[model samples]
Target: MRATLIEVAPRDGFQPIGPFIPTDDKVSFVEAAHAAGLRRIEIGSFVNPAAVPQLRDTAEVLRRTAHLEGLDAQVLVPNARGVALALEAGAQHLAYVVSASEAHNRSNVRRDVATSIRDYGEIVAGLPAGLRLRLNLATSFDCPFDGRMEEDLVLSRLDALLAHREDVEVGLCDTTGRADPDHVFSLAAKCLARFGARTRWVFHGHDTYGLGLANVAAAWRAGITGFDAAFGGLGGCPFAPGATGNVATEDVAWMFRRMGVETGVDLDALLRLATRAAALPGASPGGRVRAALADRCAAA
Candidate 1:
């Protein structure tokens, strides 16, 4: 009944903030999310610190999280160099992002679609068998600059990636938050049918146009359970201009619990994490439900 949740607050949620977040605050955020029972978390990205000032403390974050039990600490690696850095830092799991849209992929990672796929295949090939590698396929649903993404393109890319390496896990990303229920169901159905039980699909929804919740429902019905939700909805796509934050962790967890789906997440403790998020400089906590929950906690 309980579905696995990947808390992306540390990597996806914190990276897009306009101001610099203190490294200690980042540690507090991850620790609080762990207290809320988030077993899997993408803690940091091994990108250039000059490019992403927010994640300049990637090594430091990894070091602090090394001793935490019952936690799957992950880092995002864009290429082999990043992968090497992640492995050096003792990350048990690594996530690599590849975009379905060719233009977005180039803009985000400075590589064309084919080259990016090749790059990812190399990363997957070289990774130790026991370590987990998650491929986050961004712009799976739609792209701001490039209109709607073709399902065929997404599947083609998946086919190549899976064919190259069988052990990789795939994550479908609503990069611009432009996805709807129908889109989510169709794409997810395609993925589930093709992959069967061999691969796990993780849904990454953005609440940009208010379709995030509906998309989650569609994904759930399509048998896609694993998801990426940020605490207090404090995350956005750096590449997609004007994209909003992710679905709030508390909101999604509340929905699943009401529908008799167990998330194994403590809403009260999660709300406290959101409060801590709000205290971080430049973090707005865009989720309405999270704000309401925080208010209730304050009143109590």
Candidate 2:
């Protein structure tokens, strides 16, 4: 199966930083990812500017990249209001996140799980035809506030989301980076068994515990082909305590390529981009491949 890695560096990677990344720099990051052969990217989020000042110019970022051919620009929308703004900005793909843990959901979006589900339903219902939507089940593995979430609870939340819109893609998120290989494989197998042909499944993992690649491999073995990653491994959940950077895009691409999987990404170019990303203010590079590349350079 062809593996697809969705770049989230422009959005998730930059969201937790204190200083706002320049709008042009954000655009350049997207362009660099595209140049590295990534087709899909989450450029920014459409939420209250006061809440995440870093992504305040999401619309402008979208406008600047509107002419990029064959590139799918995705944006995170917190609710119906974000959905409206995303549509106004001519976004074709929108992602909504809701944690499985009630406490985490409330903390992340200031709404309870049920309310977030209802809001997602409203947003899904109002979406125009042909617009792609993805639901990120945050804390599917474990929650910082509530501890490890049960598989049944995650499935139940997924059922609620499917009930709202059966076609919306689902991404299992390890919000606090607490997922292990066995747990990831087990839950992914169950999810695939439940929703295999009905909807697409993507895995979103963090490397805080240093198991991001292992978890990704586990998910792949469980039949997941789509993944969400950030360049230089830069990202953390502002609301979810102890959460850290996401699985790095170059790291994932390198793994898949070495495994004889088709990722359609240029590893050398992606490593170069990772180097550039690491130089960004407050950026932290978290992928092993980058260090390996640095060593190779030093040896050369």
Candidate 3:
């Protein structure tokens, strides 16, 4: 099966790091990822610069990468204000994040589940006809504040969001990185069976428990073709305590390629990107492939 890997290194990967990455460095990172054949890349988020200073230059980053051929640039939008900013900056694709757990939602975005949904509907209704919108269900699996979430709760929220706008894509986020393979497969299977054709499903996992790749495989078997990953596995939820970075882009590419599934990414080039991302100040690489390959080369 062919899958689409959305590289989120410039945004997700850099956000968790404490130091501020120069705007030029972020632009270079996005360009390198695009050069490695990543068609979709989350460049940055339109959030309060006071909250996440690392991504303060999101608008500038988007402007710098707007000319990349065959690249679908996406930015995370928190509310209608974010949508307005993104549109002003010429962003065609915008992702809004809403947590399945009410407590987490409040903590992350300062709104409860219902309020977030209401806000999302307004944003959807106001979008241009051709604009692409994605609603990310953060804490779809487990919530640091509320514990494990019920599958029905997740689906019900999805149903409500779909009722407001069926065109929006859905992304299931394991914000706490607590999802097991079986649980991932079951929820993903149910979501696909119910809403497969109406909306696109994307899985975003964190490797905090070392099961990120396993969960990705489970989701894939359940008919999911879209995934979000970061170079060198760098990212963590700013609201969810103990959450780690996302599954490494190079690692996911290697897994899919080994399974005979095409991801359209160049493995060697991705590893190089990972290495460069890890070199950024305050950045740490959590991926396994780069180190493993280095060991093999040394042995040779």
lDDT of each residue in 1-300, candidate 2, tens digit only: 589999998999999888778888888888888988999999999989888989999999999998888999999998888888999889999999899999998888999999999888887777788998899999999999989999999999988889877776899999999999999999999998987687889999999999999999999999999999998999999888888999999899989988999999988888888888878887766888988877432211
lDDT values for all models: 0.85, 0.90, 0.90
Write model 3 residue lDDT over 59-137, tens digit each, in one string: 9999999899988999999988888889999999999999999999999899889999999888888789899888899
List clash counts for every candidate, in order: 0, 0, 1
* Candidate 2 Cα errors over 4 Å, as ranges: 295-300
Candidate 1: how large is its RMSD?
A: 1.5
Better of 1 and 3 by lDDT: 3
- The CA lDDT at 117 in model 2 is 92
lDDT of 1 by residue, 54-88 (tens): 89898898899777788889898888888988888
Q: What's every prediction's RMSD, in angstroms?
A: 1.5, 1.8, 2.0
> Where's the lowest-lDDT run of ten residues in candidate 3?
291-300
Q: Which residue pairs of candidate 3 clash?
A: 235-245
